[model samples]
Target: MHHRRPKNLRKPLLGGGAFLLLAALNAPAAVSFAEQRYHAYKISRPAYQRQYGSWARVEVPAEYRVNAIHAALLHTGKVLLIAGSGNSQKNFDAGTFDTVLWDPVANTFKKVPTPEDFFCSGHSQLPDGRLLVAGGTARYEILDGEVRKAGGGMRVKNESPDKAVTLKKGTVFRSPSGIEYVSKTDVTVPKATREFEVSYFGNGAMKPWKTKVTAAEARVFVEAVEEGPQALTTQAAQYEVVGLHGEDADNVYGLAQKLTTEKQDFQGIRSAYEFDPKAEKYVPVDPMRDARWYPTLVTLQDGRVLAVSGLNDVGDVVPGDNEIYDPKTRKWTKGPTRYFPTYPALFLTRGGKLLYTGSNAGYGPADKGREPGLWDLEKNTFTGLGGLTDPDQLETSASLILPPAQDQKVMVLGGGGVGESEKSTARTSVVDLSKDSPVFTDGPDLPQGTRYLSSVLMPDDTVFTSGGSGDYRGRGGSDVLKAQFYDPGTNAFTEAAEPTVGRNYHSEALLLPDGRVATFGSDPLYGDRDNTKLGTFERRVEVFTPPALHRGGANRPVLGNGPAEPGADGRATFATEDAGRIAAARLMRPGAVTHTTDVEQRSVALELTRGRDGRSVTVDVPDDRTLVPPGWYMLFVTDGDGVPSVARWIRVK
Candidate 1:
């Protein structure tokens, strides 16, 4: 029906027609907005969350937020977050080390008094429920062009067999060419060793022995007293020890190689401490013999911690000067020498050997010590394992003993090329150490090549892996926000809830006592896609609730009135109303993680027996000390539906 319109109405009709045309042209954008809103609603629904899980960004109080470079789950049900200078040069200069204690249950935070810059430290759970934290940043790295002074390592010699020599920090060393360098740290050179050997003559008389004396040496970082090119030296030189005379002057001397205004790598400290969860403070212990940055501390079967691989005091790879810390003695002794890149992923096996998964984070020759192997600690032998895909891309990879650690299987997941290379891989490999000839076999690939990926062991017998970047330190805005669940039984991955935050270098994910996973830290190189702006350290901590937690109501089994301390191979009875549904029990080692390496987290299966009363469950702890290291563990009972109860702290003596 064609109808004539009045002149006044014609203009309004024309405007309305134009509006309709514009809305029609932008239909895709309107539809997209509506679809996004619907997707958000759908995921928030109980039904959808029960299947795919859910993620919630934790609202950390602004004052308590920290970089969280290191995270450890304590027996107190609180997480310790250490950010020691937080990778910030300004913070280091200001001496602003930080640590925050977060109680997930109470949602409260407390600031800790950090004594040193533990920015690149190594930590492990101690048998006494303390956290042994060792090594840290002694000096920040100075780039080549920014280096203002000439510095290098100096070897101080004590030629006197009678008395040792102590060189103070400001001790001056005069080079042969008259350039003076000052010691940057105190060093004590041991007295020369004197040995006498006797030879026995044929059946009757003893021949006189000759005495041998060997000079003792100690190394210390030295810097030219003066800055700039005038202090630079390109030749190795012997330096006269200042403030000495006569025999003392001759007995003490300094030797150093070329000291130049070159790039200075981050140096490490020899300081070590044990964080007491009960007292909520770091207690200083005996220092290590060698300074270390980016070290890895693994607990031995005897409960001693083996500290290995890091940059030493002079900003050099530690030259395999590993040491062991005896918790009982509170001292460190020389360990068997074995070189590895910094923060190597080493797991202790049931046979007391360490399984090196060929996964490391930064600092070493790409060709050396990058092979996957089994290491004999007593004999100092390494047996290399083969068949790992993308062998060259093991740096920043995540390695873990797969669930039911008694199976003696370890897996390596996702890695990148050495250093800041742009290369990454999606490879996943598993090595069953129980095999006659253990070699890594390829598992399912990740959705994309990733680095700094965090793998957390869930009580439900699956691994939750999430948050990594496609490039080095998330350059080019390459942070991968995806997450997945890896089923060791199926040797495959299934998609899980996606993380909202991007975690890359220096990130960590740990399973909380409640079965949810808490993630922290991400220090990207740049904030923008174009890599133009410096990236801020991610201070926001995110928690992921796995599908098992969202299946229905809070019908989780509750552990009540269990033994506070139980001996290995002993049975402990726990009261729980849901004991009848308890299908399995596990002793989960609390996580102490940093730099994507956590040898501390493992789920050891316990033999479970439901009581006849249907209100109690008795579980037997394994007798093997290597299989179940002595420490405080979270006792978790899972139902047939894979729902885990809130953990109860139990000490395995």
Candidate 2:
């Protein structure tokens, strides 16, 4: 019934009706917003947090924030975050390297003086609690189209047996065809190797020995002094030394093949250093024999470190050459030659052999060195194990030594196809390395195909796995926000509190002394869903408090005074108020992690004995150095409710 009384009344009535209609139309959005707010409130409540756990982003000051390519839990209860040029071309060009020391307990950050680009380097905790970091990027990659000058590896040979010839940077070498190339760095070509050959006579009498001098060679990166195709060398040719005169010029020469404007891969450096946790400084060490990028450093049973697999100084695989570092001598010696892809998942077994989980990060041929096996360093042999599912999709996978080092079970989590491929896998496999055959068996699958998943071993014996991308470098907005806890006892995964940040390539997660997990780094190729925007490196740090930590208030057992340094196979007493409630104790090796590979993390169960006075607990440390590597560990005791106490730092000697 339309009744228009007056002009003003008609306008007022229409406005009121229109307002009512608009309110009705916006009801769904209002309800959705209200529901979202309620959900947020509910999750923030104590009960919800206690059940599903919680995440808190650390407020890192802008200047202190860095691209954390590698992270290590130092013995000082601080974390060493290394960026080292931070994957930025500008930083590399300006020689601006970065490192930061973060004290999680104190919530403080300090900028460290970095000496070199430690990006993509490998690290492991030394027996004395020092972190041994080896290898780094020497030169950034230059794509095909963007390259202006032709460059490649050059072999400088020394024919004289006198002494090594040192060629400084900018030393020029001229091709026979009249093109000039310059050395990018200083190169030392060793003197020729002298050998003696003795020829025996018919009566077994030795004849005069003849000496033979083999040419000594050193490889260095060289580039054309001028840009374009004119400087390209299509065939192998001997190059004359530009400055050397007479015999020196004739004895020392350069040789190279195929210098062109094609793509140039990332070159590596021979620099190495050890981070002293107490001093909070990186002490320079003897450089590695081979320049390496993306290498893997595994601590041997004797506290020596084995370095393997990386892009060399010339941007090629390191071949089968590996080396070992001895802390006693502060020197590196030649190691067994067995090639594996960069950042291969290698676990040291109690039997003194390394188990390769067939899991690796980037850079290798798909067909070679991809088999899961036991590497006998003594014999220099690798015995291949079978039954790994989705073998092709093993790059960027995460592997862990299942809790209780006595069990000797290793698991490989989700992975992706070789080098930027879209293929990924949800498959997980576990192998009982203690078994005679030790073949991988299918474990529970992930919810979806994932890569770069970070798995941390909890003191309570659960593996906290979180954050990965389904696509390469989280392309197409594929960063998975889910987290889960894999219970080795149950051989299944339980959903965990979802993480707000996305972690992908170059990211790492490690367990903190406070029973929480800290995650850092993610370099995505694209930032948006449409894949048009360039991605930014994630510098925000996130900490995840496991559900066990939130259980039944903060009444968890507390770790008091304990042995600062305990010998293996010895009994150590610790003061704890809740000793009577403590059910188990574990020595968890502090993690030195990078690129989703953390061979250092292992949980070794200790024999626990409660003191009669109810104020102390004694734990028997395992004598097996392989099981419990001599280093700093977080000694944690768990109560009957699976709640862990704050960790006590103990160095196992």
Candidate 3:
């Protein structure tokens, strides 16, 4: 039955203002730690150090209109930018959805048709290179209507004909429906199959589901729904109850029988569609069993996508029971029944269990219930893993399973204090999830506590962190333009080049094929909640050139020939000018990141063996799905100094 959540279930959104106390106590201490490390490495270097990376701003032509509320790096090498309502409630109500395609190679943007108001929808790339977009804004709730209520009563009809069994008048039997009712007058029952009816008292505000049953040798049946109370009286009979629609119907919601005209509507949509990159349009598919908003989609090893928690049609959180989308059948089937905080940052482990890093994208229950853990999908169980000093501060923080896929370490960094407040955290943590009992431990801190930060795994196995705000939604002068890089070897973050423009909420970055990182989109308030002008709606695109790109022309190796496709006898042959000097081969999945969560970003190190001819390298392809799932990948070969060559796109399937 649908019921209001407990008072303790709700949590505050992460923000900057809420972290003042934390910053005052921790910021100075962090500074002292940095001073101690100055002798080891220059801690005060300028953000634009040439040894790190260089950022260049690119202007978009006027004809291109974009808000970039949503973005993804497509397999075709174009960035898909979507902005429904441009973050405006009025536009959302009007159903104004916009989309654009930005081609980095061509340095141009083109307008594209939008499928629906996928304002807060969730998406993940399929193995076929298509993007599966699920959920959207069905409608917005406005508070202009009066509260509605209903009178309670119950009635029953006899289906089977039989001898009359007399029922006494004033029979105080309860109505087994949402309308909490009690018998007002009990009348004599006719032997020709006696039927019963009862009037209920109260509006059935709180009731459980009722089902058909046999009581006192008489059969009683009611429609099985999330509402309608099950009669709980001193009655004796065998009950045969039919299950409700959808698996886990009780917790699925949207089955409430009670009517409440008073509603704050912002309803979530159940529309499920596939974006065909080749056609550059969305193809409608079967709708999901439940409406979802602010959901997260993760691609499973078998190519199906597991869509986790989100708000339901009525804007209430859909507590648990995630669904899976099968690409082959083009249908959504009920997956393992489980409870997950909305948009949980889940990573598929080598063992096939899902690891929730405790860094949810946004919204859902907080407190201990949302703690980090490893979820055994097959058994529908969770193993809670604690150790985060500040779990409440991870609302917009970026988390990732560190590079080289083999390393089972996951990291969470920078977030706000609580709900839409202006306080954030510079704290970062890492945990080796492979451990039997994993727990997060403190890692290097960021330059300052931040939110909306984006961390992309580079070809070199180091992570690149950029774009975020010191405050929530880039408000209160919390814009952070400088970028940083995290080295797993040292567990340290080094300042990198600063971008020409600042990016915070709604911003994103991805590694490009040419070994540079493309950064764009920052719609904190101009087109988001609060609608306050904290920073301009970011439309300008920029690219960050990693230090490897600064090497001498001769030192930068070139791909003489493409590597063999994956699954081809598990061997790949590559020809390059620096083949003799090439020390490593790696495969990097193109990024499809949004909301600071890049569920698609992954890297696999390939075994490199020099060819007998001394002019080519024979790399052994990964045969296990855990190491390299079927999909498109950018293969890069790095020299002894770690300077990588331009990537050659190849399919692992």
lDDT of 3 by residue, 344-451 (tens): 788877877888887776665556346788888889889888889777888888888788888888899998865677678998999897777889999988998899
Each model's TM-score, in the order given? 0.94, 0.96, 0.74
Candidate 3 residue 577 Cα shift, in angstroms, is 2.3
Q: TM-score for model 2?
A: 0.96
Q: Looking at model 1, which ten-residue stretch has the lowest summed lDDT?
A: 562-571
Question: Which scores higher on lDDT, 1 or 3?
Answer: 1
The CA root-mean-square deviation of candidate 3, after full C-alpha superposition on the true structure, stands at 16.8
lDDT of 1 by residue, 1-653 (tens): 99888899999999999999999999999999999899789879988778889999888889999998999999999999999999999999999999999999999999999999999999999999999999999789989898877998888999999999998889999988788999877888999999998888899789888888899998888888888687888777789988999999999999887788889899999999999999999999999999999999999888999999999988999999899999999999999999999999999999899999999998999988899999999999999999999999999999999999999999999999999999999999999999999889999999999999999999988999999999999999999989999999999999987888999998999999999999999999899999999999999989999998898358887888878877454789988888888889889999999999999999999999888989998999887889988899998888898999989999886
lDDT for 635 in candidate 3 is 85
Question: Residue 199, candidate 3: how far off, in angstroms?
Answer: 31
Per TM-score, the best of the predicted structures is: 2
lDDT string for model 2 (1-653, tens) is: 99759987888899999999999999999999999899788878878787789999999999999999999999888999999999999999999999999999999999989999999999989999999999999899999798899999999999999889999999999999899999987888889989999999899999998999999999899999998789987899999989899989989999998898888889889999999888888999999999999999999888999999999988988998999999989899999999888889899998899999888988889888988899999999899989999989899999999998899999999999999999989999999987877789999999999999999999989999999999999999999999999999999999888899999998999899999999999999999988999999999999999888889466999978877876454888998899889999999999989999999999999999999999999999888888887788899999998899889988877
Q: Residue 271's C-alpha lDDT in candidate 3?
A: 88
Question: In angstroms, how far off is 485's CA in candidate 1?
Answer: 0.4
